[model samples]
Target: MLLPPCLPQQCGKDFRNSLKQPSPNYPYGYKTKKPRIVPAFTIQSMQKNTIVQPPPKCNIYEPQPARPTMFRKSYKRGEFPVTIEFTLSGKRLSWKVPIEKLDFHHYLPMFFDGLAEGNYPYSFIVEEGINDLVKKGSYKVLACVPQIVIPIKRALETKRPAVICHALKCIQMIVTGCDKVGEALVPYYRQILPTLNLFKDRNRNIGAGIDHTSSRGENVADLIEDTLQILERYGGPDAFINIKYMIPTYESCVLN
Candidate 1:
């Protein structure tokens, strides 16, 4: 808009000075404005923009149950505890042993005592115990043979034909059951042979009333025959020759 002229020269100078000075809207130096206050994000506003993710699924592999290797079936026979099973010469045999009547440790000693005391019924019990051990395996039979052999050999030396025959039968079972056992008894053949001669002609029912027979289905005499055969088989042909040579020496040792 048009304005009036300055009245004086000083007034015109003052007006030029004012025009040179910066206006309030357009200041010479840049003046920073106070910072604008921005309100913080609330939980509801954040939830609207948030990206929800589901948990990862795991793939766990579980194994199946294992099968048993031994005794598949339970003992169905009477109230027989401790079913004994073992393999011999590729044949597997199982027997149910009554624990009350047959204790393995005292079996051989008690058998010998039965013979010593002339208790025929007790001898049958002992025979049953031996049969139980035989059914267990050759290993069990062989383990007890060393202990059994001593008493059985002593029994052979006795005057009673029954005791001698019973002892021979027991020896026969042990020796024939396993080849290893037969080989073990080979050294004792010389000692056994001389005793066997005493019983050669003595024919009597040594195992009377003993219903439990040998595993080979033989009586005492037959058992002695089988045992001698076993010893001959394992002792080799040289064993017979050795026995011939051993006889004179054994005779001399006895005579002296």
Candidate 2:
């Protein structure tokens, strides 16, 4: 097969030429390409990624951070009492047992414990149950004040706008829920007012922009101040003193 003699210079020249030529890719070989010329603007853009990292997480677009609460555990365990009916108007909560028969010592704190939940049927049932209990339970709500403080504190401590709004509303309900509920709440001000104080100035200045949450009553700062006013109004003689002690920034709406 090697009968023909070849020149060394010619063989070397052929090998170098082969190295310069484009290698076979698929069906056929192609020409070698010059170095790519990227646009100067694109090069600058690639060097400095000018797009924002992302919006700060503190805003409301993010879902409320959930905390495990006793009521949530009970609901998951199917130990929650009351029957719910979803009707044309809205959801209706009915007691499986008579409202009068339900022990405040047992059920009141249990319903209050659900305040941390911001989602679904749990929020509805908890809010409705508390409302009904506050309306019907009479002096029982006042009696359960000591037991329910921790749940109230826990709900507000989450610093979630929605949960805090719900808890503040519940506090307002509890304060005006009946006679002496506020007075009863006075002693436990230390436990409850810290979160209130923390969120007391939650009133955001959107600068002439209409706050839809205000109309929806979902604003936490306003709710806190309103809750404080309700407390000051009904929390009896010592209520203001205790609230003032816990929340230094709170002013009396009742007096000058």
Candidate 3:
């Protein structure tokens, strides 16, 4: 008997021989066999081959440069050095100070306070810087004197004699250094004269042996004398007459 082509040769021979001697259950040809079960290893092998792979990882960390601050940009405006020259103790002195280093606007109040308190070293440096600026005849420096005069006058009213004296010294330096600056201060004379009057009778020797001979010294008499000289120079010869009229008796005695 011929077997079907779909079956294996050996299996076909066995099936053909069984067909010839059919059992009562399969009388016509042959009974249908049950389906074969697949192995677990075959299913695992198919799953492994069908899996999708992941893509390559990217680099997350990389260094970056730092950004500059606001102050760093503002500082660029004051980068230039300003060379200032003035006389201190009858000797010529000069300093090339960076514009940023001279924070005058912020420290001017403290400077006045220190001057009034007989802080000579600090006062001298400040006064000399002003004198140097004036001597340079800088329009920018001269323009600022008008605004500064009133504060200096206010400083004259401090209860501390040393402070009053130093304020006077600063005024003297301002007036003596430039005519325009002196003229600018003329209007404040009324406010200044009264303060100077308080120190007229003060004859104490405050700075005696300091090597520096400056109006910033603690010597009360020198301060009064220098202030009077500055007033006369800028306020004209009749400047004392104004002071005299303000306080007749005291001015008369001082003048005499």
Candidate 4:
């Protein structure tokens, strides 16, 4: 609406200056602290807008369980001669049934052969009436081997010597039921000696003489008596003869 038209020049100047000043509605200034589209320092995590599908999580392939190891057969009843092959090296060794399979008992010859040639898997057999053969003085054993430290542990671990000896003896005993010391004791003595020899020299109880008097309650005579009794049980005439020939003269000053 139209009103009074005339105004002073100074009044017009003041009015223009008032217009230039900011409006009272926005006294603190138009640029107040606004909600930022891209925040300076964000609290909430950014939405993963790039659609980052992770390189598909790898399906970890677990290996299957290993199968149990199977071992070769020990021996068969009907199979007279058995050839055993070594697992690691594939070396072959054999044992044969003798013609005198019913009575033969000397393992020393076979043992010596195997030891000399390094031929393993030697079979041990004890046939019935072997004691009769021994009694007849037919079982003659000539040992060519000089003393050496036999590897008992190695043989045992590899299922040799002792195991083989035991298995063979078991088989023979099963077949023939021959219980002869001449055959049965030889393997035990031979296999055990190298280790036992270590103890023999260090003999504490059984001293220089068979009839030695001791301050300690135990006596060699008693021990001898006990051993003799045991020998009577396990040793036959052949064994008694062998023991008489082979065992060191405890009555004499025979060191080990």
- Evaluated with lDDT, which candidate comes out highest? 2
| Alpha-carbon deviation at 161 in model 4, angstroms | 10
Across residues 106-171, which tens digit of lDDT does each residue of candidate 2 receive? 888988889989898889989999999888877777678889999898887777888888888888
Q: What C-alpha lDDT values do all the predictions have?
A: 0.49, 0.79, 0.53, 0.33
Model 2 worst lDDT run, 10 consecutive residues: 47-56
lDDT of 3 by residue, 1-256 (tens): 4433455555766766765564555447655555444344455435533433334455222112223322223324543233234555563335565433455443333333334333434446556555565555444445566556556665565546555665776777666765665656555667767756655665645665643434447766567766665665576555657656654544333346
TM per model? 0.44, 0.73, 0.46, 0.20
Model 4 weakest lDDT span, ten residues long: 66-75
Question: The CA-based lDDT of model 4 is what?
Answer: 0.33
Mind giving the per-residue lDDT tens digits that candidate 1 earns over 1-256?
A: 2233466665766877665554556545445455433334534334443433434455221212223211111112222243333456542324455433455445544444333322333345445545555555556455555555655555565545455556665666666665566666666666666766544433446565654554434345455555565565665544555544544322221113
* Candidate 1 global lDDT: 0.49
lDDT ranking, high to low: 2, 3, 1, 4
Candidate with maximal TM-score: 2
Better of 1 and 3 by TM-score: 3
Better candidate by lDDT, 1 or 4: 1
For all candidates, the clash counts are: 0, 0, 1, 0
Clashing pairs in 3: 116-163
